[model samples]
Target: MSVLVEVCIDSIESLPIAEKAGAGRIELCSSLATGGLTASAGYMKQAARISGIPVYGIIRPREGDFLYNSDDVEIMLADIHTAKQAGLNGVVIGALKADGRIDETVVADMVKAASGMGMTFHRAIDHCSAPFDALEFLMSHGVERVLTSGLAKRADEGIGTLKEMVAFTQGRLSIMPGAGVSPDNAKRIIEQTGVTEIHLSGKTVRNSLMSYRNEKATMGSGDSDFAITVTNPETIAQTIAAIRA
Candidate 1:
């Protein structure tokens, strides 16, 4: 069986690189520099129009919090409701309580909302009070996968526990380790965790050095563009090669 390399695409431009580099799946979002936010239906449709592979939506209303307010929850519901219609293959979401626990009630509603589509628990699982508890809950909730750094800043730091989680999960759930997986260590993580899927950006930042004179309209306080990061095609090929090796 092949280990799926899930590439996170930040723009229409990056999608072709991901498709060409032998990635099995993609998580499409806007402004991944801001830890990712939901891509619009128009963007989602455009992506779906281009590639035949599955594109999972990052169903976050905004950056900064894994927990959502009532209105934000409604927004997530709406996003999920329309995502498949926009031709997306799945929806990614996570919401937590202030007490560092899975917001069970909210998550349950989300699960129901995303019933027909593929569902993944986003890295919000990283902030959960108890890892196994939250994991089992997601499994029971029928979440297809959990995209995480194993509750750590990077997968290397969480490798030990990620192994434990993989053992606990057996084959019931997909434990996808993301954030910092690269060509060099991608093989090591798989050898260690024996997981079937890994997520990657294989990306490098590309921003204009030229400053804009219109300081009043600059989102970055005079920066020219919204700051773009492109997927490294060589990194993608190298990561898959390592996984196969």
Candidate 2:
């Protein structure tokens, strides 16, 4: 079977582009500048309405560390409910303890909240001390898939660990290699790691259309100043073609 390509999109505008590019699925979220936060209910609804493929809503309340507080858990649970109500096919979630282990309590609650929807544990597993243990934990908790870079900052650098993760899982759950995935490397990554699924942003920098430019002023604290990154359909198509080839 060909590898499944999933694009991480921050806006609903990317939905049609991704679908047109033959993306098998999409991970929907907001605040991509902060590494993606939970998307709003309005966005989720619009995404589901417009997307032809499955839309998995990301349930992250914020960026930075995956270790979430009680309030964060509450917000994530609420977001999961929102995703389900908005008719999303699944939800991507992750929570880690301060000690770099899966926060079983909070994760279980989120899983319960996502009872009938497809559930994927996000890259928070990369923050865990033991990838094997984390994989087992997620499997035991009924997670359908895991989006990870094999505990490394980038999937290409973590091919060894990713292969190990795929071998260890033994098909109990999917091991999806993500982060820095590109058309140039998708095939090699899939072959090396034996991962059936891959995730990428498939984005390119787009300059703002405003004619009046303010060189001194900035929008958000992050890199949201002038150029915004948007999904490139051609890039997504190339990635899919590479993986299929």
Candidate 3:
């Protein structure tokens, strides 16, 4: 079978674009600017209503490190419940201990709460002290897949670790390489890592339509405060083709 392309989208407007571009799955989120956080309830419901492919809502409760507190766990569980109620097919989750290990108790609670729904342990594994051990822990906990950059800044930069992760899984779980994936290197990453699934936003900047120039105030941290990020159909399609080639 050909590799599956999972487009990570931050808005409902990008949903149809990703689907029409031949995305096999969607990782729904908000604030892609901040590496994606939990998508709003309204967004989740609308995506589930309109999307033809599987939609997995991200369950991250906040930004910053994956080391979550009890309160964060509470919020995550509630978000997972919201995703299910919104009719999403699955939820993506990740949490870690201060020691850079998987938070087994919290993860187990999440897995139990997400019963009957697909679960992807997000790149939090990359933050672990032992990624392989973390993978085994997640597999034992019944997570279906993992999204990671192999503990590096980008997937392509970590091909060796990615290869080892794929070999280690042995079909007990799925390892997906994400982060800085592009059409130019999509085929190389897949061929080198043996991953069956890949994730990317395929986003491009669209300057705000507002003609008024607000030079003084900036709403966000970066220099592109006036620019909007949206999924590019051509980029997604090209990535699919590259992987399938």
lDDT of each: 0.87, 0.89, 0.92
* Best candidate according to lDDT: 3
Model 3: residues with Cα > 4 Å off, grouped in runs: 211-215
Per-residue lDDT tens digits for candidate 2, residues 1-245, read: 77899999997778888889889999998977677889999999999898889999999987799988888988998899999999999999988888898888998999999999999998888888777888898999899999988778899989999999999999999999999999999999999988999999998778888888876877667455778778999999999988887
Clashing residue pairs, backbone N/CA/C < 3 A, model 2: none
Query: On a 0 to 100 scale, what is the lDDT of residue 164 in model 3?
Result: 96
Candidate 3 overall Cα lDDT vs. reference? 0.92
- Return the TM-score for each candidate structure: 0.93, 0.95, 0.96
Q: lDDT winner between 2 and 3, please give it.
A: 3
lDDT of 3 by residue, 92-125 (tens): 9988899998888899999999999999999898
**Candidate 1 lowest-lDDT run of ten:** 213-222
Residue lDDT tens for model 1, 104-196: 899999899888889989899888888789899999999999998888899867898788889998888999999899988888988898888
After superposition of all CA atoms, the RMSD between model 1 and the true structure is: 2.4
Q: How many backbone clashes does candidate 2 have?
A: 0
